[model samples]
Target: MPRQLLTDELWEKLKIIMLKMGIYDKPCLRKTVEGIFYRLRVGCPWRDLPTAFGNWNAVYKRFNDWSRKEKLMGIFNALVVDPDLEWEFIDGSIVKAHQHNSGAACEQETAIGKSVAGNTSKIHMAVDACGLPIHFSVTGGEVHDCKEAPKLVAELPKGDYIVADRGYDSEALRLQIKDKGAVPVIPRKKNSTRGNDEMDWCLYKYRHLVENVFARLKHFRAIATRYDKLKRNFEGSIALACGLLWLPM
Candidate 1:
């Protein structure tokens, strides 16, 4: 059998969530789910999946269907229970896009963009004080962090502080965070007249939490490299990876 990524304990928990989400149990459900996990963990072409998990096409179809229905995202969200709200950290990371992701019928919707590093996509993410992903969005790599900040900030739960790196420094964004009832702990750029005197250097050190979450998610090879031709599919992969982090909880 292909290396199993989900333990019996984790699968049990996931099964309850799936059933609750209306994904009915089937004799092959576990194997199908395992097939999906294997692809995500191994980062292999769908057709390359081992027969131990059943037909590769069937597994891919189910994944695509779940992704389209947003069921996978629902599973991820459902797993997020009470998250630490003391602080919310936001950041973006670029994923190198494989050539296989090209040739989409609607190229513009692919969420692929050219950057200094060549073709790439960016994962804009928000994590709670515990460094667990709470929200995220995918964009073309060329999209600026500040450009996606407003949407992420708008969706963030009210928290004590919203922290980000200097790349996210902006007066407007700071005001937005203030409007959300959270202090913006973003440092100002050197060229800015307003200095970072009020910045919480101590709290800023914890910004690494969000970076750490990104590092952990990328350990899933599917997340480390972008292969999905559609943005929704890619986002589904991200949601699954994020949900996996919360599985132990």
Candidate 2:
């Protein structure tokens, strides 16, 4: 059974968007997308996806191509209104790197550090109040959360509030956020040279929204377990999951 997250009318509208975006041309595109979403919803591996939908490789390939092209970002951007555009949260989560996700010869270029878990990847995401992701970056798990703050904040709209944990407290990150006309709401570190930074405990409490987004994203087993061998494909799955998050309830 097709677990319908979209109504028939909405599905038709989505198909039109895909057609206009040239995503409907591939004979297997629809089936591939369906199968991928099925796996996401059911928390199954690509190869474990039911064969009735189509070849797992084909679906994975399409997903990778779209992700590289930023099609998923476009699709997600088109679906949701940018609410609280000035309020965003920054957070990082460590994913246990599966052997299947290894063997990327190119990853050496981006490998910065390793986590206590040994082989792992860190996903840094910036999300709006609606729990919609605005920007994301990946790095070695050992990378400091504060190191990616600048990059993540760079993608946010100007003059926004970026809420983060003490891990993101740093003079460089604060200046970067200020350069972008955004407020840095990171709590002060215990051993910091400067005294406690100004914090909005009330608004900071809402920082958990980004954590909730991470929780929802990890709900997809592939994301949690990471069966995709390619980093691009894994990122694509994250974008696709974000698109699903935009669906009307």
Reference-based lDDT, each prediction: 0.93, 0.74
Model 2 poorest ten-residue lDDT run: 104-113
**Top lDDT prediction, candidate number:** 1
Which pairs clash in model 1? Answer: none
Q: Report RMSD for candidate 2.
A: 2.6
- Reference-based TM-score, model 1: 0.98
State the lDDT of candidate 2 residue by residue for 89-121, as single tens digits. 889998887666666667433333467987777
Kindly report which residue stretches of model 1 are placed more than 4 angstroms away from their true locations once superposed: none
